[model samples]
Target chain A: DAGVTQSPTHLIKTRGQQVTLRCSPKSGHDTVSWYQQALGQGPQFIFQYYEEEERQRGNFPDRFSGHQFPNYSSELNVNALLLGDSALYLCASSFASQPGNEKLFFGSGTQLSVL
Target chain B: AQTVTQSQPEMSVQEAETVTLSCTYDTSESDYYLFWYKQPPSRQMILVIRQEAYKQQNATENRFSVNFQKAAKSFSLKISDSQLGDAAMYFCAYKGRYGNKLVFGAGTILRVKS
Candidate 1:
């Protein structure tokens, strides 16, 4: 059983540039949620995708967007990035229709550094 | 809005000893879930333990146990017989009954001294 997987272990982008991160949900899971973890800080929720639609979003600005494919994989896109965007982008997968006891499975995360 | 807070920025414990990490969350929903995730140097967010608000009994997993105080919105994690592998950043997270997103705390770093 493969767990959640994310692409681009690390990335570097300049201010005003855009970056895209990818995630493959864990097997048997259909919901994918994105998070940002600043240095030395816990991860903050970005958004969650279910049934190819965003079901919940955090306080993030409109510059951040996401997409969930029919296969349950997801992508996080950040546009007009700033230095504050330098953080670890994490992807977690869970079964949205399951009971609340079903825990989330997270990927190793992509380390993004904005110049 | 749900939020989590970890008061201890850093904590240390001798190997084979025990260590406790404190966490408190704010939420209005009576049905929800609380979790403690460990992020090691590898950067993988690993689920350590979890508690359901409906269950009054605290949750425990192997050497990891949680003191879940739903009335007080407190969820403290206790690691028994700590080992070097237990050294990592511990995070407290919460999710509402209808939401899939997790709100996390600032995290507490744990160092195991051999």
Candidate 2:
């Protein structure tokens, strides 16, 4: 079974530039969530998408937004990025809505560097 | 709001020895889940083990086990008979009963000396 997959394993952009990171959830999974992991830090929840609608969001600002396609793939978009936006963008997927199923299989993550 | 904390930034243990990584969380909800995820240099977040808050007997998976004190809001991971492959960054995560979003701690890096 293919696990969660993310695109553009690494990215570099200048301040004020916009970036969109993609994710394909694991087979048999329908929920997709995005996280940000700064260097030497743990992953922080950005938001979660279920049934093609955003279900929950974290403390992130409006500059961070995401979408889930009908096929269960997800895209995280950051507008007018700041240097602090530079971090590893992680994508995680779960099989169901069950609380126990949310251990979440994570992707290798897209490392975004804002210079 | 929920939060998870890992007090230790780094730890080391000799090969074949054992070590424990500590974690604590803050949540008002009565039911939730705790997880230990291992991220090696390859950067894949692999699930090491998990514990459900309602289970009082604790959760054990092979050499990896957790001490879950729900009343105290503390969950700790103990890895027995560690190996070189166990050298990695370990993270503790939390999720409330209703949603799928996870709250993660700062993470602890484990070094295994041969």
Candidate 3:
């Protein structure tokens, strides 16, 4: 079975520009979550999507948004990117939205560089 | 909000030796889960081990085990017979029983010397 997969292994964008990163959830998984890992820091939750709707979101601002397609794939969009946005964007997929069953399978993250 | 903390930013151990990475968390919820994830140089986050709050017995996976102290809110990972391949950034993560959201610690960089 395939694990989670993310596109655009690396990217570079200037401040105020936008970027969209894609993710394909693991097979048999229906929930997708996005995380941002800055240099020297742990991954921080961005948001989660289930059944094509956002189920939970972290402390991130409105500039960060995401969508889940019917097939359980996801896309994370960061608008008006700041230099601070430069980080590794990770995508994790789980079988369900429940807590105990939410063992996440993460993809090799997309490295975003904002100038 | 629940918070996880890893006191040690870096740790080192000789090959074939044992090393323990420490973690502590704060949460008002009675039920939750703790996880240890390893991110290698390739940057893929892999789950090392996990423990449910209700389970008193420590969770073990092969050479990796966790010392879960419910009262102290501590979860430490012990890697035995470490190898050079064990070197990676280990992160401690927590999630409450009600939601799937995870709060992670700053991460501990482990170096296994050959």
Candidate 4:
């Protein structure tokens, strides 16, 4: 089975520019979540999408937003990016039906570099 | 709000030896899940082992085991007979009973010396 896949393994943009990272969740999974991993740091939750609607969000600013298509693919958009936005964006997917035992499968992540 | 912390920034162990990575979390919820994820240089977060808060017995997967102390809100990963492939950044994550969002620690880099 194909695992969670993210596009544009690496991206570079200047400050104030906008960036959109894409993610295709693992087969048989419906829920998609986004995370940010700064250098030498662990992944931090950004937001989660279930049933095509945002279910939960972290403490991120409004510049960070995401969408989940009917096919279970997701896109993370960052507007007015700052240099601090330069980090690895990880996409994780799980089954929404499984509440307590939900296991997340992560993608290789898109490395965004803001200049 | 929930938070996870990994006190150790880095740890080293000789080949075939064992090492333990420490983690502590704070959560008001009575039920939650703890996970240890391994991220290699390739950068994919892979689940190493997981422990549910309600389970008193420590969760073990092959050579990977977790010491889950519910009262202390501490969860530590112990890797036995470590291998070269085990050299990676290990992260401790938390998920409450109602949500899927994970709270992660700063991560601990494990180095295996041959």
Per-model TM values vs. the true structure: 0.97, 0.97, 0.98, 0.98
Ranking by DockQ: 4, 1, 3, 2
Model 3 steric clash pairs: none
Error of 1 at B50 (Å): 0.8
lDDT of 4 by residue, B17-54 (tens): 99999999999999999999999999999999989888
Residues B1-114, candidate 3: write the lDDT tens digits: 889999999999999999999999999999888999999999999999999999999999999999999999999999999999999999999998778688999999999998
Off by over 4 Å in 1: none
Cand. 1 TM to true fold:
0.97
Per-residue C-alpha lDDT of model 1 across residues B14-52, encoded as one tens digit per residue? 999999999998988999999999999999999999888
* Native-to-model Cα distance after best TM-score fit, residue A84 in candidate 1, in Å: 0.9
Compose the digit string of candidate 3's lDDT tens values, residues A26-89. Answer: 9999999999999999999999999999999999999999999999999999999999999999
Alpha carbon deviation, residue A93, candidate 3 (Å) = 0.3
Q: What are the interface RMSDs of all the models?
A: 1.3, 1.4, 1.2, 0.8
Worst 10 residues of 3 chain B by lDDT: B95-104
lDDT of candidates 1 onward, in order:
0.93, 0.92, 0.95, 0.95
Residue clash pairs of candidate 1? none
Assess the local accuracy of residue B16 in candidate 3 as a C-alpha lDDT between 0 and 100. 100
lDDT of candidate 4 at residue B69, scale 0 to 100: 91
Where does candidate 3 stray beyond 4 Å? A97-99
Estimate candidate 2's alpha-carbon lDDT, on a 0 to 1 scale. Answer: 0.92
Estimate the TM-score for candidate 4: 0.98
A66 Cα displacement, candidate 3 (Å): 0.8
